[model samples]
Target: MLLELRQLRIQPGQQLLLEDVSWQQFENILAELGEHRAARISYSHGFLEIMVPLPEHEKAKEIIGDLVKILLESRQIAFESLGSTTLKSDRMVQGVEADACFYIQNQAAVIGKNRLDLSIDPPPDLAIEIDLTSRTQLDNYQILGVPELWRYGKQGLKMNVLENGKYVESNFSPTFPGIPIIELINQYVQQSQVSGRTQAIQAFRNWLRDNI
Candidate 1:
């Protein structure tokens, strides 16, 4: 599988799926791919998916992640940003690498840890995915038990909150109560594309000051 991966070239916005992959093979593939690469991987049961994100996918991810950081900072919330870190539970046979993940309520649990073992450590409080290429698998996140998920794509930002082991779409983020997050993210993400990221972020901060 490693040799085949070396020869395979997955273009941006494309995904390669392999079925019947064992857990050991999934670990080996992750080791082979390393952490600095552009491709994102997701494993559920015995299936594996490797996807390369397009430029716009990365752009939206960055801007949205930055916005989340600003929101947290303004609210005086302690948080840790772990960008695209692999979150997997061997016991559940589920694994996923989110575009952006934050340890907000659970920040202290992972403060000094260099590695995460989902079987022991708590899953991220919030996970963000840029679905420009439709590579996100909701089942993977649900099975892993992430509490909150933000998916930004052509349809705009959608927030999914975990309830009773299932995801239910919500307009407000539990992390940022009373802050019209859906409307704010949709408006600012579009603004970033046109007015530039720096300007858009500053504008968002200004809005937060006046409103919140």
Candidate 2:
């Protein structure tokens, strides 16, 4: 069953809803997906979300191709079959759907599967969070073994990438190299809705042609 909670506010009296989907079910689904970097899903404390890091960063632009699809694009949604992979296992870890996830290409990275065992080594290169309800950032990444984490908040986006066993300020993304996510955010902010990816891409092509 797909659980769509826009603003999942879990308090003392509201912990009953989560009991519906056990962690094992989540694990089974991921295991079924086989292998390829699928969206990572996990929920801990009171937060539940999905995380996805494309194996081919270029695939993002291709996936977001054209205007019709772009207009229909959601701020934080997934493709039809691309679904998600969660980190909910045993009684210790809960799962949360990562608003956005970014990971670099590596042998250890989970790729092309319905479900994945993120508990294993080489989690995500970076995971992005647009905090809608939960606030358990401190231990969440550690639990997922993600190298980088960015939590979007009222004060814009704050980034942190693991370095030398410690989380530090991060301005660069290990996944999509040479692309400033901050600029993308600014573009999104500047426009109420993003233009069709095709149109944007065409514009980019034209600009490139003019310059080069």
Candidate 3:
């Protein structure tokens, strides 16, 4: 019994989601990132959600590719976005996870801290959602004051940019120039786990040179 229990512990634990989860409990990230005690999240609304912290754009792609594979294997929903803001809709928002979020650099890219005190306005440039179990608001970018956000769901990928306070349909990103969003998604999905990330990024980059 003791040996069996120990072996079980070595295996990956099943993800636990709140039952009857609305869009309010998306705050699990605060707990995961060790910022729960410090954060002041007034609202969280989503049915399925996860917050991924990345060190760089390269890392972002890597994380995203891994996430895509995981979602497919688990039959979980997922989405990828360039960078936008997360909105705290007072309505039913819970159990949602924004996978591999993207944000444009204000000057030089600054490393995201566990807590981003945006003061008045400092939202990310892009945000992605998998939309596993619920329809978490499709217009989050507009609510959060961001100019653009990419959403991927059961219907595949779609881009929405907020222009003049209204969400507009867009393809190709200034944030990520000349990137065919769908192709990147496919590359990540088709390749091996280890090499998929690197290959996906290379495929998306306008020009890439191999060294060594």
Candidate 4:
């Protein structure tokens, strides 16, 4: 499997699916892929999906992640940013790698820990995914019980909050309440593309200071 994986050439913005993969095989594949690769993986039941993001996808991810950090810092909230970490639960037979994930309310629980086991530890408070080419599978996140999930794509930003063990679409973010998150993310992410990340982030910080 590892040899075949090495031969697999997935172009950017593309994905490949493999069926009937077991939990041990999934773990082995993750080990083979390592932590520094560009491909992201998601597994559910016996299906495995490997996606390589586009440049546009990564740009949005970094900018939005930075904006989130700024929002948390401005509010003096402590958080741990785990970028593209492989989150898996063997018990549930599910696994996923988020574009960016953060621990806010549960920050203390995972502090200084290098590895997270979702079967025992709480899922990230918020997870962000940039779906430029491939759509993210909501089942893995929903089953994992991530409190907040944000999906950004060509259409716009969509927020999903976990409720009753399922996902409910919302216009507001429970993590950063009372702020126009949809508007802010859409506006600033576009701004970053147009005027560069530094300027866009500075502008957002200024706007946040005045408003919040």
lDDT of 1 by residue, 132-181 (tens): 34334788889889999999989999999999999999998999988999
TM-score for candidate 2, please give it.
Answer: 0.51
Error of 4 at 79 (Å): 0.8
lDDT of 3 by residue, 1-212 (tens): 22321132111212223234443334444444443221112233333423222233234445454543343333332332322223343332312224445444432233544334333335555655443222334544455555656555445566787778888888775555654656556445344245755665454342223210
lDDT of 2 by residue, 28-82 (tens): 5445534453333456654444434333322332332221123223222222222
lDDT of candidate 4 vs native?
0.92
TM-score of every prediction relative to native: 0.96, 0.51, 0.49, 0.96
Sort by lDDT, top down from the best: 4, 1, 2, 3
Q: CA shift at 16, candidate 1, in angstroms? A: 0.2
Q: Give the TM-score of candidate 1.
A: 0.96
Instruction: List, residue by residue over 38-156, the lDDT tens digit for candidate 4.
Output: 99999999899999998998999999999999999999999999888888899988899999999999999988888888999999999999983434469899999999999999988
Better of 3 and 4 by lDDT: 4
In terms of lDDT, the poorest run of 10 residues in model 3 is 4-13
Cα RMSD, each candidate: 1.5, 9.6, 10.8, 1.5
Quick one: how many clashes does candidate 4 have? 0
